[model samples]
Target: MTKRAGSAGRPTKPLLKAPVRIGSVDARAVVGELRQLHEDAEDPDVERMPADDELFGALLYVEKHAHALRRQTPEVQRAAALRRVQLWEYVREQVDVHQMHAVDDARQAGAQWIELAPVLAVNAPSAAYNKAKRLKAVELTDETPQARPLRRTPEAVLRAERRIASERAAERQAQEVAQLRHELLVPVVERLLEQRESFESDEDIDYWWEEIEAVLPHCQTPLQMVSLRRYLDAVLRALAKIEKRTARPVALSEEALLALAAARKVRQLDASR
Candidate 1:
């Protein structure tokens, strides 16, 4: 049975001497500083405490040396514990956000709620869906450590659903834009590659050719899709400069011309918006 949602109380505050805002400082720097202070208290002469470059290793060292830390003064121990608690809280909040995103992705990939039930440790599909919704609601809440958490009310859940849907729609549109741009660029790049040997000896074409070559691998993957259009424009500009002195005009395939038109229309639409 689903338990009734309770009213959210004042959010838990870390046992910090001065309330340090979470995320305002880099985690490595904060943890490293705390580790230094604690280490100094434990053994001031230890030469091998984790340096700035070895923050992760230092964190692991502290984990392994927890027992030794117990002998340190109460003040030192309390400060360490406070930072740990705050960091863990932030980590848990991010975990919930990731979990919700994962569930959304699974659903998009055609995984039924019944299939997710087992993975979510829930007995039924509805429970799994509700749990995901709750997590989404939590993500929509203020991230400040002391902010009161959003209650799992019907209204809050509805808001979460709407926000998630809007975001997913935006993501789909961006992906579509990328795919369209890729289609526009591939043919142009193929033409460039065909003419590469001819351009190799031309000192004037060398700079732009090298630039295009540097970004070539990235164009083949969606990893840099957002910048792909810019790269294509640069390549086109370079091609224009190269075309000026060549006896033959650079020509594009009929399909490539159509794609270029479509891509420009998309760009115009985006600019108008």
Candidate 2:
């Protein structure tokens, strides 16, 4: 496929580089900004910044001066109350994220639900599992620091499980695709491009060359790079066929030959799958 005329580059900056103090005056705007961060990242499964350390520190400072805090104006008191609630919301989100991941890790490490139940402050194995699922559901649906309590219903848990599975699969695929590009596709493509003049006279390589050239610049992400795979595969096949059929095959540098060998192994794995 040809490159899109003006595709935007991948965002390099993280959603929240540092802990940000939420404004009590405009909760909705804060939520909107958070939502936009996720959108900007293309909804990748990645860890975000946890609760602000300073927020908790400030809370502790207030506690130490409790009598002085009580002497503050009603409006100031109301703002402090809002800030306290927002801090709790932030901490709650961090707790849910950590707890859900920790439970999964413990299970993967061969720990059972019965063992986890007491530690989770739940009555039974099923309760522990259900609680984790509920937390996962909350994580999947709600944006951070929600004004209202999270509605972690059973229905939401079911949906969250499905989303969790999808996100995991996408994450794995993106990683594998990136590995293939870096270790196999990129080096081989680089060698071929450097030897472009060698294939200029060959009619057989013209189509694949055009394809590779057009697609290379746009391979910025797994989603974009995925489409370039067919073209790469075609180039390998074309080159191999040319070597076999012609008495005078296009000469390859040692680097090109080695890169091609590594790339062929990846191709075999893909074909087997």
Candidate 3:
């Protein structure tokens, strides 16, 4: 049976924290990493914590939590618990004791907590951060910590990258062909629009009709019969029209008769001379 994880009816119930899964490595390896960080820290008396207070704060935090944090894997549950303890101590050491601007590193650790708490822990982010800080000081709430700034993402750039990668060679070819058509088709359309050239060039339709008819005398193919008969019928119709015009005399106008009479008088005058 496929077991569903979430409760069907009680949707509003928050998700619980879960353990982080370390790859190949186990819980002891992370303890070793934390130990190395703790062992290397310089004493506050010998050297003042660096002016870049956030770094010193984070380093100190890792040292303070190293013991409890050792057993914790980088996995969500353990890491969340470790961070909560560390942050709680840091905040308590602040408002309760010194209350002045002493060890004021809330923004650094708290902001980091806001960002990472969810991945580390598996519950609501605001609730987790609050719970983590409140364990030491009783005053923290869901709204107690200042909000973490939103990080920007290059979604458009990533989408473009994915689109280019996912496209097939045929799709690329189609885009190229479309772009080429736009470039080539526009000029052709403009030329036609201006009537710069005939729709069909004279060379395109120039029929070597005499050559076609010459083949008719020896034409023996079935396909040639239709062409031959069509051509001969056209020729016969043309000849019939020519003979009809030749057989009929055109009626002469009065102006033509007058011109003929004048030419006769001129011929008579030449004879007299």
Candidate 3: stretches off by over 4 Å: 1-167, 192-273
Which residue pairs in candidate 1 collide? none
Query: All candidates' TM-scores?
Result: 0.43, 0.44, 0.17
Model with the higher TM-score, candidate 1 or 3? 1
- The residue pairs that clash in candidate 2, if any, are none
lDDT of each: 0.62, 0.62, 0.39
- Candidate 1 vs candidate 3: the lDDT winner is 1
Off by over 4 Å in 2: 1-57, 142-151, 163-273
- The sequence of per-residue lDDT tens digits that candidate 1 reaches over residues 1-273 is 875677554353331123232543366776676667656666543356566455455555665565666777787777777766666665666667789899999999999999999999999998888888777665454334754355554355676567668889999998887677567655656555455554323454465457566666656577655455555565455555656757544434555444445444554554464
- Model 2: what TM-score? 0.44
Question: For model 3, which pairs clash?
Answer: 20-75, 20-76
Q: Which candidate's lDDT is highest? A: 1
Q: Residue-wise lDDT of candidate 2 within 1-273, one digit each (tens)? A: 988976865563342232243323343443333333433434432123222334444445443443444454566556555655776676666667788899889999999999999999999999988787776654454334542233565555676567668889999997886666455666667666666665413665778878888878767766656656778788777877777778554445565555566667766776666
